[model samples]
Target: MKVIPTACTAALLAGTAMSSVAQGVYDDALRLDPNSYETLTVTVDGEPMAVRRYEAVYVGNPVAMSATQPARSMGPGGSPASADGQELADLLTYQKMAIYVPEASIEDQSTAMIFAVNNAGWFASELRTSVETGGEYVSTSDTDKVGAALGAGYVFVDVGTRGRGIVAADGTAAGKAPAAIVDAKAAIRFLRLNDDVLPGSAERIVITGTSGGGGLSTAVAASGNASDYFPYLAEIGAAGIDADGASSLNDDVFATIAYCPITSLGYADMAYEWLYQAQRDEQLTGVSLEASQTLRSQYPSYLESLGLVLDDGTPLTADNMTDLLMQIVTQEIQDHIDEGGSVPALGEMFEFTSRGQTVEVENTWLSVVDGQIVPFEIQDFLTFVTQTSALKSVPAFDRTANSGNEGVDGENTLFGPAAQEYSNFTPFGWNMNEVAGDGSGADDTGLKWNEFVETKEGQAIAAQVKLTDPQAFLQGNADSAPYWYIRHGMIDRDTSFAVELALYRAVAGTDGVKDVNFTLPWMTPHSGNYDVQEAYGWLASVLSDAE
Candidate 1:
């Protein structure tokens, strides 16, 4: 295959790698067979910058298969392949492709495309990555399954963005949002270039994903308002025209299905907040609301309440608590922090119970409830935390956070991407004010995003809100075919089909959608894990029906 440089650089800034790819000056690729393969060189500018390896797949099979053995999906080179069933294989695999290197330190617009596949796979449908879960890859991208589906008289293909890693330019990328538009355009282009992908039928497209990937599927399927949400991605790197010689997001996607998808980054904070409490006590899901209020109410107080005690039990008052909180929080968190320009420091503390001196500390601002402890100047505490965190807090945090926040800002607003003017870059949710909202500690993002989709107001502002009520939410926009698919895991004892319940309530609503389709099985993790047979089965079914 070949290396295609895309408009979006995979890497962020110099010191900050948008992804794990180490910046290098050399960028080289190799082409073999119809599908071109590029070798990412490890050097740049006549000198070697650190070169890193990334995993990518390419399929030579036809597009349309819905069922295939997973292990057999890998191509000769271990490039990304497919395992879709055979019926759909003979449809979309064709020559000629357009690829963009979404991001990198090397170059922008270094893009290519050789032979392409309107392929599908039965993998979790998406590859995911996380230090905790390892970099997850989309199993569904496997073309074998797409080819197999072709034999079944169906055609399929996947569109994705951010070629290899992620770029942190925007504030909402936990690795999902930024890549959304790019991937969608790529897939649409793949369809246009191929003879099999119905040139006039963009709405026939079927979108699917699992877990976080599922959320991606839903976002891409975006139905009618595709460009409205991410207008930035309206046109791909090197786009081509369709039968009418006109471009269309309609040829883009017809339907979308995500298995355990997290469609809105705005909701991440709420989800994580609830998740944190749930970890401590399953019944404490309500605590997320409490935490939101707690952080909000206490933030300003901390800003105005910075101080230090003169080695005794007394205290010294200061106006800017930001210094103290920033100092102490950084000290408390160490190496596990997300890199940023100037993160504020407030509502933080350094535990100094070591020296034989004890100090009484009480404040409505911070969470330091321990009566008498150690004594250290608030400013000293901040410096110690931010500077020495890599050494001190890393170990301490790793141990304490066994059940607390990862300090990595998994989804909590406190650590989500920073926002700016071009903020509307992403749709289906928040703005800079919402993401990096008024030092409220964390932005109250995606507030009621899921339900907005079904409302007329939601559709009008589809580019702004992240909502879901496909039927009523879509107002008269939905087809009368009460179609719906419910996926539940018998293995997920987590509230016994919580996803199904949420999906059903969130979509079906009191109005109840017509022609609804639902499926539940003894598979899938408790919302986060879908790495089993159940996941593959769910994807195959969803894609098949959508096709």
Candidate 2:
């Protein structure tokens, strides 16, 4: 066991006193017996928990290339650097992780592990703090849904990640584009590196998360072992080994379970407008009808550009988007009714009488066939969904100005790092004049935009959006997980249904993507991991096939 003092110093200084003590004990044990496995008591949220600790293992920090080492920098192009030729300071965010194995001997256990993440709204500072405390430690209570796994002998590991809204005490933008994804990959590498000492089969790791965390899970699965993220991984000192004269141990997972994932960032706004355009005439707060119309007009071209097709090979176009949505929504309702759940009464068909003009809306997709609404229509479903108001303003995601404050929304903040307050994420939101076309700035929210593409910050912002999106991997430019379980709520207006649909098509349509189980749960909201038993069964099936 070779202990690197510098890496250890970095971890010890960044971590708490209790962590230092635990690392010290683990280091001593490693020195005495290289293959020893030990448990340490660590405090999480002021609660004491017992677990195996592997603290402060350096992966490898990114350094400038010299004549002696020409290949020091790895993964993707456009590696960020300081003018002084020094690498970004390591150890600031390079922390340790704890592992928990079920009650079993280390050598006799081959339990599968869950790499659970806690990220919502793309901000991960809270999660990162939790990891430093004790690696997102889980207890028996966490297995309420998936207790079958633990009861049947499985392991659970929580991962802490850096996200879009983190500013270091020194004001450095530590959590930015590629930062969260890079940390995720590093954590996976750490697990694989210590697979021998850990009780789980390293090859059977399943990634899980909800919302933004779900987006990350999908991204990790889609971009597995791709060299595009290597530079960021190396920057954070991720674990790797030399194999066949090349760096090996890339972060790849066996399967992914993403619930209500907010992905396809580039096309979310268009999808939102296209889906909810029918409600444009209705009075709603924080919504701009003109802005909705403008974005709605642009959706057709974008939808056509994706080249996505249905399972039967029909091109998914704006012309048939309504029908496509109805098909999925109907299935969701039918599934619920089949499970013996009663459908709410919103009337089989209704007439919205507004301003002395009555408009008849037929429940085209759903009807009261045999006195039972087994399937529901899009209009009635949306009426129930938007009963109060629209979830977001026109051009929901990339708001020009922050509706809450003088700044921008979280999605906008996600594009630019924590250093800069916020910037525009999409080109549609780039030129307010173009999106609105009519020269009306009524929908513009006063958000900042990088008008000049030649600027360094502008270029970096564009690159970050491209890198964070999961669609690139689904397109087959990178590796993807063999099995996937993706679910989104039918009424989740946090992101457009188009985003999830596009992702499903990309994964299912692509060659070599073995299995994809996609569903839009009836009447569900922005949530994840609620169906633990079903997920456990899916995990069992995948593992069974592997066996």
Candidate 3:
């Protein structure tokens, strides 16, 4: 016989002891104490699975702005009215989250929490679906990170968020531009709301992820309770709002550890071209020299617009951009060499005539220090980078068929809804005219193009782009997390190296941000959260500082 805890017992177990009793009385008890949960034993594929279900705990009151309209209806499907003529509000859409506390007592262990979000390629609807179905709450001992965090007494929160490409059951675009970010903030708020009942220091939460997930993590750290997201948050019925029109919970996080974040969306295309155009080898596949050059030319002005300066307060201009990047790359390589790691030979196959004889040179960029190649030249390393082929066509992020032969890129899909597969997120990708009388352009389809910038839809898309970019938050426009740990791979071509550099400069250059550690791991590629030991160390330091 399975022993189930009553709602009263569960509530008491939160602060005291856990005692098991009869299971049949749970339903009546749960209705009285909605915040209570119960654990059940079930058989799945002949294996006994102990599952804890925490259901329908209202984060905040759901009410309509006016009596005429139905109470704030938002969720997977269109807010449909019930048969009895009452609006059924689905709090599960953006208001719900699951906490997986370890078996060990949390008070005896560390008080840190990990809010892990699963997202890739700037699309996240699938992850949200998994959370709603209780899929992500599986055994946490599978991975080293999860196991280690659990062993160290950290609570794991599986956050359900809405992102681009998530079409509702009613065929409406429920998850779009600001939905993902808004949902993330709401999840953080949920943790803060249950701080006393939950088993961790809500203030010491560490948000971590890779790629687009990493980007969102950075965004969450950078924009904490920024008023810009309030409208969207209200639209989805996010938790923590009081009847007096005040927020009862905070959405701010203690620290952020992002890896290979595909961020700075609006300017990523130009930055990619500026860094890789010189390396364009036509023989390689997808190499568009004309398109690359056109996009590369726009980077200088865009860099100037950011008004970004180096640590020494030097303006970041297009003229000095290449040199600056080279300096960073060189330093990373030198650091590797200093740590007793081998520096890879450059210009290995390049033959040069020395005294009327052809000689194959290796380590051409390196300088000898005490019989060892310790120092390297920036220009030579740059020459090596330039010889490589470009990753994408011109206007990589928001690729337009009219601009180049390439199809719609991932970012274009991210900007549009499921109904529209691709749309231009930036003005640079917008074509003035279309094919013949139709706005098809060279792509032979009107769907790939964007509406006029002055149009309502166009304005909305532009706003979303700004709202999603992390740079907007770092510019003092929003509240930022004090501690940050950022890492990107050296050879990752998914986005430009300059994009990550810009992020670093923003954090390092900013006044209030603290304990910023930005690094480019040698030969690491388009990934994150590698080096778990170092991350744990950073977490320790952050926790100490918080105390």
Candidate 4:
């Protein structure tokens, strides 16, 4: 069994002893009354696991409209699969976050916290999933994300995922998807449904996370299908789903915070290098560029041919990719740097060589794995060049294959793709920039492409092949309920603060979220060790703004 603060352990034993044995009937008795936090233990496949206590705290007073916490996304599929509207057999891969309101205490009258909890480098089965027993669910271990939420003065719910609990055997985010995001959305809907449960949940809500989770927060802020995930949700729910998982495209969330977020899916190339270099300055430090690039060349299917496919070529230096580059293009705005420092400048930042034609695009960090080469927005050549990827020096991970991913291994991905895919696992795709009219006895690129990607029931569509390498998703309300918060601190360590700041700018700029951007004094080094004072200050300001 798992141990608590010792103070709570004795009480549990006594409670168990008092159970009633009425006429050969077993009466419910033993109950472990959790303190503000505690650690729970259980075994899966004979291995012992522990879960820490997390809570939705009330920062006491003036209301913490800006209450926030960290969330996460980790495990196998470091550089996860890529997908989007285009029919280029894009493998479906994504990392994201969720937000929810937990019952708050009397002192909890405050702005909803957009809590973020990073997924450890996979293997967060305990917090991410619960074993349902009739009407109740048994909690699992792996609660660092939950603990971070509690430390932030807000209720913490699991980001909910058990990514292929594999570390890049050598960096990749490929494999089966984690259903954790689905569980999280359920938590959010539950907190909002049936007032009797967690009735004190705040009306205002937000999301926060890093790495894959960071990417999640960004999508959550988009204001779309996220609300539909829980259609019956009174306040806390996702919108709906389109081709992509849950849509956060048009929701009304109060705020979102993403750190070193994995933003796009269609603009990927030499991926790991692009990510690490982008945040090296703000990050405590990162893997050497040489290491990142080395891993980049490994683990990907060698593209037979890939010259930029269109005029809207993606920026590869920032090194991020996504399925909806077109949608992101519409949303891309220049970064607002107080002082023009090393902040990457678009247009002049990235370049892709194809058929001797060096095509460039704003290093807006958009890319996708196209055949052999990581394709950008702009179509360059037909046969894209490609290669495998690998890790330079395997650094010490915060998460081991077993217990520490939640602690740190997961966050490592936040810095860049894992060293797994370095073994060369290439996925394929095609460009529809031009191929005649719709295929009704026609060969329109769009028509043929769409037809190619259509799947039959449970099979991979013609335009795609499941890497089956292991990846994950919240994938829009696969079910009716879920519980989630942003994920932060790649399974390795804390980073991604820049994107979180950007999320504030996006929300505050458009909606009247009254954003607050402040850092915890000793928040890094490890992802935990939250400073309540800082959170209190920020939350207080948000409340004032809302009022």
Clashes of each: 114, 4, 2, 169
Residue range 1-547, candidate 4, lDDT tens digits: 1101232233333442221221101001111123434444533333343433343211011011111111333333232232322231211111222223332332454535444444433222222222111212112222233333333445444343323333222223322221233333333333332122331343445555554555544544442223222222111122221112222222334455444444422223233333333332233234333334443453232111121112154421222222232223222211212222132333344343322355443444323222122334421110011111122122122111211112223222222122221111111112211122311111232333344344331122210111110011112223211222222221122232222322322332332323435232111222321333333445445645666
Which residue pairs collide in model 3, if any? 279-386, 435-441
Q: 263-338, model 3: which lDDT tens digit per residue? A: 8888888888777655553323343566577667888898888888887889988787767777777677678778
> Residue-wise lDDT of candidate 2 within 174-251, one digit each (tens)?
566666677778778777666766678778788887787788888888888766564455444566522111125657
- Arrange candidates by TM-score, descending: 2, 3, 1, 4
lDDT to native, each model: 0.29, 0.60, 0.59, 0.29
In candidate 2, stretches whose alpha carbon ends up further than 4 angstroms from where it belongs are: 1-94, 108-110, 125-148, 241-246, 284-287, 347-376, 400-406, 433-451
Candidate 4 has its poorest 10 consecutive residues by lDDT at: 380-389
Residue 360, candidate 1: alpha-carbon lDDT: 26
RMSD of 2: 11.9
Number of colliding residue pairs in model 3:
2
**Relative to the unseen true structure, what is the C-alpha lDDT of residue 80 in candidate 3, on a scale of 0 to 100?**
25
The candidate maximizing lDDT is 2
